[model samples]
Target: MAAIELRNIVKVFSDKRRGRDLLTLDNINLDIEANDFVCLLGPSGCGKSTLLNIIAGFEQATSGRTLVDGKQVERPGSDRGVVFQQPTLMPWLTAIDNIAFHLKLKGVAKAERYDRAMESIDLVGLRGFEHHHPSEMSGGMNQRVGIARALLMNPSVILMDEPFAALDAQTKLEMQEELVAIWQKRRSTIVFVTHSVDEALVLGNKIVVMTKRPGRIREAVNFDLPRPRDITSPEFNDAKRHILSLIREESTRLAQAS
Candidate 1:
């Protein structure tokens, strides 16, 4: 059985100002198997984030159903961890404390919480900086804290919404490598949402492309390229070319409609 399933899902948003409803996602059907790294790739405003939110139970679908681990998703739980675009950490809390916040909420003792959080802290390579507050860290460092916090949950699936979009190119590449390493060791299912084709290609084992507004699945491509993928390789270029063509066609259609 798939670790996560979205069966004929549809999401409609009420546009109060326009006095009409807007369909954000339409007839979306997806099945994510265990330990698979899936990236939702599309143009901005294509409802990629919305779909992730639905799976995370932060939002409800207008129709159809969402299931995680064979159970319907009704609300957010520790079984599924989410990392947003922003770090969203408490400004006053130190890195270790921020990572341990979830454990604290569950009424776990302070000593145990700190101990468990330390593992994730080291995993993300923020050992010596654990005592630093968010205000004292770089954007990339704070984002690490966010990822570490999620990792400490030991969730079956991790949902990310453009978590590295704010980082510089070099930092982004480093984080991608670290994320890949972590996934390799932990073998957790990851549903990552990003607008960048290159980002999706670098991180995901499978890429699901979506169409513009009122999003629908355009294609689900399986990538079997060897790890530490060389972006300039012939196979990589071929896959990129195919995906680019699909995205170009979608953009042209949207442009003409407008």
Candidate 2:
């Protein structure tokens, strides 16, 4: 059964200055199966992030419906955990405290929160740096804290919006492997948004490609590549070629329209 579903979703923004209505997403429909790793891939301004936001209940769609676990998504909850592009941890809090912030909000005791948060810290390989503040950590470490914080919620669905886009290439690769390991062990539903085709192929079991602004689904491709995917392999290149062709064609079509 589908863990998350978006049916005939539409989002429109009023351009008050231009005295017109701008359509951002049009009739988006998607079904994300339980424990599936899906990626929303497209060029910038394609509403990929907007779709993620809608699923997270951070924004409302102008029309249609979003359902998670057979219930309507009216607002954000602990059941849906979001890791934004930026690591928005509280600078005042240490790594363990930041990971436990949600638990604290629910009035969990400090000792209990710390204990629970510590488990996640170790899961993300941050055991040695539990007391470090955001300022003292590197960008990658801070992002790890963000992931740990989200995992502490034990949410059924994890939403990531280009969470590693800001890191260096080596760091991004390391994080991707670590994330895959975590997902394999936990088996939670993940909907990740990224502009990179390679990243999508590496991380997603299913990839949904979107068109340029006034975005719509171009296609949904399923992949069953072996774990610890070799980027240099022929099968990997074949998938990459197919997706690259789709993106290139879309870009050309948009160029001609303009």
Worst 10 residues of 2 by lDDT: 239-248
Instruction: In model 2, state the lDDT of residue 145.
Output: 99
How does candidate 2 fare on TM-score?
0.98
Off by over 4 Å in 2: none
lDDT (Cα, tens digit) per residue for candidate 1, span 92-145: 899999999989899999999998999999999999999999999999999999
| Candidate-wise lDDT, in order | 0.95, 0.95
Q: List the residue pairs that clash in candidate 2.
A: none
Candidate 2, residues 67-132: lDDT per residue as tens digits? 999999999999999998999999999999999999999999999999889899999999999999
**Backbone atom clashes (below 3 Å) for every candidate:** 0, 0
Residue 109, model 2: lDDT of 99
TM-score of 1: 0.98
